[model samples]
Target chain A: MKLTTLAKTVAAAAIAMPLMTAAASAYELVIPTLDYRTGAYAPNGIPFANGFTDYLTLLNNRDGGINGVMIKHVACETAYNTKQGVECYENTKNTEPSGALVYQPLSTGITYQLIPKSAVDKIPVFSMGYGRTSAANGTVFPWIFNFPATYWDQATVFVQYIGDKEGGMDKLKGKKIALVYHNSAYGKEPIRTLQKMSAKYGFSLLLLPVDHPGQEQKATWLQIRRERPDWTLMWGWGVMNQVAIKEAASIRYPMDHFIGVWWSGSENDVEPAGMAANGYLSGAFHAPGDKFPLHDEIKKYVYDKNQGTGERERIGEVLYNRGLVAAVWTVEAIRKAMEIHGTKEVRGEQVRDGFEALDVSEARLKELGLPGFTYAVKITCANHQGPGKVALQQWNAKAKQWKIVTKFYEPLSDITGPLIAEDSAQYAKENGITPRSCN
Target chain B: MSPDFLFFLEIIVSGLMAGVMYSLVALGFVLIFKASGIFNFAQGVLCLFAALALYDFIAPGGWVDRWFGFTLPVWLGIIMTAGVMVIVAWLIERLVLRYLVNQAPIILFMATIGLAYVLEGMGDILFGSDVKPLDIGLPQGASDYMLDTFGLYVEKLEIVAAFVAAALVAVLAVFFQKTRIGRALRAVADDHQAALSVGISLRTIWVIVWSVAGIVAMVAGIMWGSKSGVQFSLSLIALKALPVLILGGFTSVPGAIIGGLIIGVGEKLAEIYVGPLFGGAIENWFAYMLALAFLLVRPQGLFGEKIIERV
Candidate 1:
């Protein structure tokens, strides 16, 4: 028995020795990705994970690793669960050598849990487009960033779009709007903004919440039918989005009148409903489809070399492109960190500075091979959310493509500004945080 | 009828239809538990696997197209999937059930939980982890005729699902009551050793029962998948069935159906009438609450056989 045990230990050492050596040999910029590749949400999670990982791989292959320093992407699967996400964060936050530079949780629930920890750990949490909206207040949430737009910004954009559809903002009076949302922190993020808008515009706001996994929404749609709201808005994710679109179609609700948040606007959400998903609108920050020059580069450097993270055909889906955009911002931020610190090796605090000082202009975007893909994002110490501009995209179900129908429009900062202040102030009081002064 | 009464009626109608869908998933559980005396936690994953297989066979540019170079007809794809499920059932009996003959029920249940993860992982590896639209010519969209006549909204897909569930129940009832193998299955469920002494093959009976459960899972998967695309969330519909099982009894087929109806209508009414008071989203917990209350009063359930143990 001792001989057999000794042999087994020897074999295990033989297997792990090479891997340990490879890990120890390189001094790379470590970015921990808390991804969900399996579970009920895997249908949506898989593509985004692929997009994020593939773009990082593109940097490794094409540019020879972010100005000569290799990027060591340590991915931990969370399966879209809050507990698992926190575990992933704890496990990868202090990886060997330089520790984790930044974290993109890709989940709102996980972001909420990590917000307090991030301040202590000083590891910046960049939840692109989906996290605590008040984290936009950079003073209170110095280590947290949700750039391009937050849920509050998207809600205001949706209200403005509805008003525009009705000819003018004054016409919104007496109009009824229903919000079908997932029953979670992520879905509830937009309710306050919509309520303030409804009260200001004289419209009735109806809130309907769907539980997790969200396969059954018959009751919610029945309510929508009875109310006959002038417009319906949804803040849903994963299967909830698909089920809501299908239910809306079943109730014969005009698809054109229904809108979803950016998280809800994806090919996986609409294709399930078939032709009925046509004309369904959703708030978007970036262009969909794989027509950009980055696609060709990724194909040449990643797929041709057989190192692609996902299938070749799934290049430019909405979520995939969103992941690409996320990777783009992350890489640019890393470059900014290197420039600021005057070294290739940087830590979490340095990356936090990089995120705060990010300035991805249109000319910079064109240089990065994603021209006109999205609006410019300029982050500052006082403003981590950037200009909260969102565009509306319509699903052409027959063609299986999303077309950007409106130009990028700004959010209602006049309303979101005060709400952010109030919410952040309350949060600061509860958490005993002293809001930092930028000026 | 008044507009308020009409709205109430509409909710009831919708609830009843939705209940039928839940009953379909619950039926798979009832079958496995009744025959094997083991609560198969993998039943939900089985439905997901079956649906993924059926989609792979029937979908354009799927496994069938990639490998065989031809798109399979819907009927043929279903039959092929049924064959695959039968093989899976046979393998499960041979590998897992055969070794654990006369094991404790909890042990068997734990084995099934392990089996669920294995099958989920295998399904992901076989069929890519992406949402695939499943269209087996099932009628979708709201029923215009019902809306036009009664001012009520009902989905055509739900109506078809109701018919399919009813038909499946009728067929299962006959299969269990009339067939010789059904008699053997009952004997095995009663006493494994006694059935073994009588020359009945326990392995064969177990395989047959699992195959039937697998086929039921396929039907439930198709119905639910047709409504809301074939995806991983399709497995979660089994969660909606737990209340139905608790209310109806795990071993009673008719109880599964009736319990589904009650839970469905009960949750819908609660969500519509009482949800507003709680800030909405009461549908998720309403059924479980009702089931808990029912369990306190009748632990054996509405149709479950009463247990009497001698001290």
Candidate 2:
């Protein structure tokens, strides 16, 4: 019995040895991803997690990590619950040598919760396209970074596309536009901006709030059928997207008139409705498909070596591409941090500074093997809303692909800028935060 | 008739049809409660599990072909799922229900909640968390002919679901009236002591009732799963079904069906016609508010029996 116990103790020690040594190493950047691989959102969550993880794997294997120091990626499953997300942040924020780098809370609700906490902890947050739109005002929210584009930016893009389709921006008058939004912080984020645009453009804005985990929208569709809104925009997620598309198709609503946010444009959302969802349009930040040069490297080093994160074929779906873009930005920030700090290794605080000073131009993107994927973003000391540009993707049933039909549109800064300043100021006042001056 | 009036009538028609879907789920709750006096909170998860099981057996890149060596047709897949549910019912009766016999109703209800978590976890584990297309060749889309002839917009899937729910309720009613085991179940539900006095085994009745509930759940899962994919949100239909159960009264089978329709129509009507006055999406709370208002007048529910205690 004593010999058997001794053997078990030795085996346990051996199992824990690599983890202990990895934590103590200064030659690695720790990125603990807060992932939701289970629960209601997992259908959408799995592909995103796979894309995010696989990109880092590609860099680690092909390029010998970021500047020779490897990445230590840890994933904790939050199941899309806000409480669990906070717990995951608490559990994995501290790396032994480098401390924590940055956090990307995939859920907007989770991002809101982590905002105050992240500030207190002095860790930068990256809410990539789907968090507090007012966090675009980096002067008020220095710690919160909603770079690439915010929901308000995307909402403005949708209105722009509508305006373009209607002949011109001046023709938006007397148009009946409706907003069918999820009833949460994530869904409600774009309401104020849309309301402002409605007043400016002389369009009627009908706001419909679908409760969380929205499945039953029969009555909502009936009202739409009766009211006959000329155009509708949906801020939906998971099963909500599929149901809305099908219900809209059932009522014979023109698919071209109904648009969903970027989060609502995944394959899982459209394929279930089959051919009926043919012309449905959605907001997109990054181009979808695996024809980029980075794909070749990823295929050779990660997937070929059997180190891929998810199903091999699903690497180029909408959400997966978004996840890959998020990681690309994350790595670029890390590289910028290394340069700014003039060190081979950097800490989270230095990384935050690097993020503020970072710039990913078209030339940098081409060098990184992602050409024409998305617009270049440059973060400034006072401006964190990097390249607030968005494009529209249309689902083609016959081709079975998401084809981008519009070039990226810049948000109407004349409207969205003041709204961001106002909301972020309110948040700062309520939370006792002193707004900082970049000068 | 005016187009406005026709539109109102069309919304009402769809509301009633959607209510039938809710009633189909409430039908499962009524069966177990009538026979065994347990709420069976796991009814929603059971619905998802059944659909997941059926879809996995037939869907390409699903649980069956990935884990097992064989594939089956859609009909055989459904039969295989039925067999799985029977085994699930057997395991529940033997392990959980059998031990908790004669416990307080609240305790039994809590145990079912525990069962819900277990089933949800097992479903996620056995079938991966990704949503699978659950097309068993069911007809989808609305009939253009119906709309053209009568200016009515009726969904073909909803109409099919309505007929299936009616057939289920009718068959269950006949079985309860004509079968000896059904009579034994009624006796047990009436009084456990009296059931024991008459040589009816309470354990056997409980097992039979649970198995019937499982089958009802499977049918409900198929319809809802067919509407959406076989995803985690399929389990949330339980919340929608609860208002139906409360309105229908827990013990009456036909009452459950009618109650489901009433709540469904009430909520839909409120959302479309009345929702404009109040911003919209009132379907979420309208049913609960309606049930709450109805309960104030009829505490025993629309068809539940009056309770009298002698001091």
List, for all models, the DockQ compared with the true complex.
Answer: 0.73, 0.71
lDDT string, candidate 2, B191-280, tens digits: 999899989988888878888889899999999888878899888899999888778898888888899899988998888778879877
After the best TM-score superposition of candidate 2, give how far the Cα of residue A161 lies from its true spot, in angstroms.
1.1
TM-score of every candidate: 0.96, 0.94
Error of 2 at A113 (Å): 1.3
Which residues of candidate 2, in runs, are more than 4 Å off? A1-27, B64-71, B309-311
Best by lDDT: 1
* TM-score attained by chain A of model 2: 0.94
Give the DockQ-based CAPRI class for model 2. medium
Q: RMSD to the native, candidate 1?
A: 4.8
> What is the clash count of model 2?
0
DockQ-based CAPRI category assigned to the predicted complex of candidate 1: medium
Candidate 2 clashing pairs? none
